[model samples]
Target: MKYQARLSLDVLFKFIFKITGLLVLLLLGGILTMLVYNSFSFFLDVKPLDFITGLAWNPTGSSPTFGMLPLILSTTLVTIGAMLLAIPIGIGTATFISEYASPGVKNILKPAIEILAAIPSVVIGFLGIVVLSPGLANLSNLPNGLNALNGAILLAVMALPTIITVAEDAIHAVPKSYKEASYAVGGTKWQTVYKVSIPAAAPGIIAAVMLGVGRAIGETMTVLMATGNASMMPTGFFDSVKTMTATIAIEMGEVPYQTTHYYALYAIATVLFFMTLLANLLGEFFINRFRKYHAA
Candidate 1:
């Protein structure tokens, strides 16, 4: 009876796992169907080449054109800026925590990062507007307080905890023996970390970066509140900017019921959804490759 019960449980577990996977795939499929259904008019009427290559964004005007270039450029620029600002600091913080920090230090630092993650984006936005924007204006030559640099700075702060935590977890997962072996071969502590731990933990670092990217890409409240909310493409770090997520968030409520502009909004959303999907896929692929390289 015990043997049969164990076998039945195992069978049930396998069945549930398969069903769960199918459900996830179906959920994704359903979302795609909805987006496409709503977006059919836009895709059919809007010239793909024009939509992609053109730069105007008069979404609510009389002769509204839906060229996505400005929004796409702004979104990409902010995401890149945030990543550039966050990744190095995050990686360094992770390395220090995993390899050098004492127990007390680690305990303090870890909680600090966790708390950062828990803070609402709106609060961050408010801080940016009230505190950071003034500071940035005093620091820079921009006329208004809001700009890409300010948004990127706040986003980097927002991204820090996830990057640091995930990266630390990755580094910790590297076998201690790898470090020991490096030391046995006359390697210094820093050398061992740079050579063995970082290489071995490369996948996790990439995963962390990708996770941070996703957060930055999907972020709305902070970007909307902090980015000066200009719709034109950005000219420099100090320029007011708009992003795809912000555009959708701001316009979703006010758009015509079923106009081409309406479909265009859905289409832009679809682009973001796919971009995020691609980022995850690429991140997973690189992570697996890193795993195979170091694990084997």
Candidate 2:
């Protein structure tokens, strides 16, 4: 009787999990469908080629321009800048916490890093406005600090917690025997960490980077507030520019429903979604390749 009851509970749990997974997939499918439907409506009015290749984005002026090239360029620049700033710092912080920190220091530092993730994006944006922006402006003698660089720096801070946490977990997941064997072969701590542990954990680290990229790319409020909201082509790091997410967020409320501008926002969202999707796919590809190589 006891064994039968246990088996029944196991089946019940499996059914619940299966249902939950299906619900998640359904939710994702619904969002994608909605985005596609609305974006298709926009593309019917605006040529897809014009939307992609246009150089201006003034949708409300007497001569409204709908070029998205500037927005795409800004978003790409910000993501690249954030990754350049965040990746090394995140990976290094993870390495230190995982391999070097004493238990007491580890407990304190890990919590501190994770706490950054809990801070609201608005608060971070405010700090960028009040603190980082002016300071950077003063240092560089730029007209204002609110530019791609400002947004990128804040995004890097936002992305760091995710990167650090996942990377540390990956480092921790490295088998104890591997480390022991490296030591047995008279390998130094640094040598073993670089050659054995890091290589073994490459897949997880790559996943962490991809996750950070998603975080940076999808961020709306921080970029909206920090990036000065200029819709133009950037000439340098200090030049102000608007991102697709920022544009959608800043203009969505004011644009009349069912208007071409309204539909364009949805199209921007579709593009943003696919950009993140492509990043995830590339990450998966790299992860699989690394796994197969390591296995062999």
Candidate 3:
């Protein structure tokens, strides 16, 4: 009787899990459908090539252009800069916490890093505006520090907690046997970490970095507040630039529904969605490769 009851419960839980998974897929499909449906009209009016390759985004001009190249470039610059700053520092910190820290130090450092993630984006933006911006402006001899560099710095800070936490978990999850084997072979701690532990954790680290990229790319409030909102083609990190999320936030409310401008915003959103999706897919590819290598 007990065995029958257990089997029934298992079936019920399996049915519930399947239903939940289907619901998630449905939700994602619904979002993609909505974006495509709204943006379809805009693409009809503007050649897809022109919209993507054009440099101007003057929606209120006499002729009104809807080029997205600047926005795409700006987002790419900020995301890349942020990753360059965060990845090395985040991974190093994770390595220390996982491999070198004493129990007490680990307890203190982990919670402090995690707490950083809980801080609101608006608060971080405020700090960028008041603190980091002025410092950079002075350092770079710019009038103000609100530029791609400032946004990248802010995004790096925002992404750090995620990268560190996930990477630390990944590093910690390396089997004790692996480390012991390295030590038994007369490898130093650093050598084992560099050779065995990091290699073993490569898949997780890649996923963590990709997750950080997603966070940096999709962030709205901090970039909006700090990135000066300039729509011009950025020449360097010192140049003020606007991101797609910032553009959408700035214009979506005022844009008339069903207009070309409205549709263009949806198109930008679709492009942004695909960029993030591509990042995740690449992460998955690397993860599979690492898993296969390790398995062999």
All models, RMSD in angstroms: 1.4, 0.9, 0.7
1-296, model 3: which lDDT tens digit per residue? 99999999999999999999999999999999999988898899999899999999999889999999999999999999999999999999999999999999999998899899999999999999999999999999999999999999999999999999999999999999999999999999999999999999999999999999999999999999998999999999999999999999999999988889999999999999999999999999999999999999
Tens digits of lDDT, candidate 1, 94-212: 99999999999999999989999999999999999999998888778666679888889889989999999999999999988899999999999999999999998999999999999
Residue pairs with backbone atoms closer than 3 Å in model 2 (clashes): none
User: Highest TM-score among the candidates is held by which one?
Assistant: 3
- Each candidate's number of clashing pairs is 0, 0, 0
Candidate 2's residue-wise lDDT over 1-296, tens digit each?
Answer: 99999999999999999999999999999999999999999999999899988999999999877899999999999999999999999999999999999999999999999788999999999999999999889977987899989999999999999999999999999999999999999999999999999999999999999999999999999999999999999876788879999999999999999989999999999989899999999999999999999999
C-alpha lDDT values of all predictions: 0.91, 0.95, 0.96
| Residue pairs in candidate 3 whose N, alpha carbon or C atoms collide under 3 angstroms | none
Q: In model 3, where do residues sit more than 4 Å from their true spots?
A: none
lDDT for residue 113 in candidate 3, whole number 0-100: 95
Highest lDDT, which number? 3
For model 1, the stretches where C-alpha displacement exceeds 4 angstroms are: none
